[model samples]
Target: MSAQQRRGEPPPLPEPLSPLIDAHTHLDACGARDADDVRVLLDRAGAAGVQAVVTIADDLDAARWAADAATWDPRVYAAVALHPTRADALTDDARAELERLAAGPRVVAVGETGMDLYWPGRLDGCAEPSAQRESFAWHIDLAKRTGKPLMIHNRDADAEVLDVLRAEGAPETVIFHCFSSGPEMARTCVDAGWVLSLSGTVSFKNARDLREAATLIPPGQLLVETDAPFLTPHPYRGAPNEPYCLPYTVRALADVVDRPAELLAEQSSDTARRVYGL
Candidate 1:
């Protein structure tokens, strides 16, 4: 019995009955923002059938917290890397620290790193494309050296992203975290054997392209994520998103792929565990 449900509480609904894994999230960021809010979030998520989550921290501060959080719970894992939008804070010292943290046992991957041209203006330290490229390369190299999967966060700069990744040949288990792209791009990534992780955005009525992307991914390569505290699914789109709300997104993904949610949950969860080597 879980805390959310009492013995007589309608038998707890069975939680959609699937082994689902949220491949990308920011538990520490959301948790620290509200003073241990993540624990309640994770508890709710567990009740909803999410077996595990990989929380990513894009900066040093977030990295420290994520590492510590993972230490506190086996269901939580961490990924340390500088996000594209935060590329301005890049320093040799920061890189060194990230590298050190990446070596930690809980650090399962090396990213949330990539290009983000969607911002109105360049992020403070990442104003130049060259510097962003250099930083991306460094992270890629780190992934290779560490033998960890590389998680990516792509924005408007798809072409350059493809170019850089192709040049670098990407790590073996490359993933497009929070994948929000069109059909053609999804096809490209799928053909490249990259994993495409869908988030709450897929549940949007207007996200036709992303829904199309869901159709292209096979069970072995598909994944689901919350990217929590942001991108809450429909019906709860405006509320604070946590892992508990992930089922809504998963249900939406099932609709896109024309499969039942239970099977989709099993497939996506298995795929995610394989990718993260869990």
Candidate 2:
């Protein structure tokens, strides 16, 4: 389906709360092609109390764009890496470029990297499992060397991802962006001092397991994100998502964890700032 057809309508903004930060998003994929577009999106977010955002890169071109996009606005930061599906593209030249980008002033993390067993057999051109593991390990080392957080993107390969992290020795800060696992994994990550960045998926009516997991996470170990242009949250599930929509997820998370929305928002934002070193 085309983007327009898939994104039926932009959801109405939720009521503003304490300042929040969207720990993960895709400004380029969300249709912010230039500085002005970036400003417009961020302005909407700011009005809804979203103070900052971290745009994530899933490939070489996106890594370059994310690093540059961070320069577009003070509120924007970046995380750079090749997605597991595109691990084959991480050639020697690409690795050198990513190393350079990871050292950029606005680059805050090295990630969206980890195992993705779900796509290997189902999606054409998806990287083989072996390639994904090799690339994930390289990205982990890059994160450690750069002294930046490791932003992970795990999909149906939780065990494999954890095993690789154990083998490679995880970076000081590891974030499971758009964390989709249940309470068991949540406990495992929390016990290991890794951050779990929850997304709109936690708000779905059918996400009882995720909601349960949310209750298990300590405020300092938790975060909120839009992962926008996807996972638009419950009421607006099929609609296009953006940073401005973060308040909805924050409120939903507050409900799940039985905390005041403003307090949760503040805590999550603080966690984001610390994790990204913003």
Best by TM-score: 2
The most accurate candidate by lDDT is 2
Summarize candidate 1's per-residue lDDT along 63-107 as a digit string, tens digits: 877877777777888899888777767798998999899999889
> How many clashes show up per model?
1, 0
Local distance difference test, per candidate? 0.81, 0.93
RMSD of 1: 5.4
**Candidate 1 least-lDDT 10 residues:** 4-13
- Per-residue lDDT of 63-100 in model 2, one digit per residue for the tens? 99999999999999999999999999999999999999
Clash pairs detected, candidate 1? 88-125
Find the 10 residues in a row with the least total lDDT in model 2.
1-10
TM-score of 1: 0.90
Listed in order, each prediction's TM-score against the native is 0.90, 0.97
Regions of candidate 1 where Cα sits further than 4 Å from its true position: 1-17, 33-38, 120-126
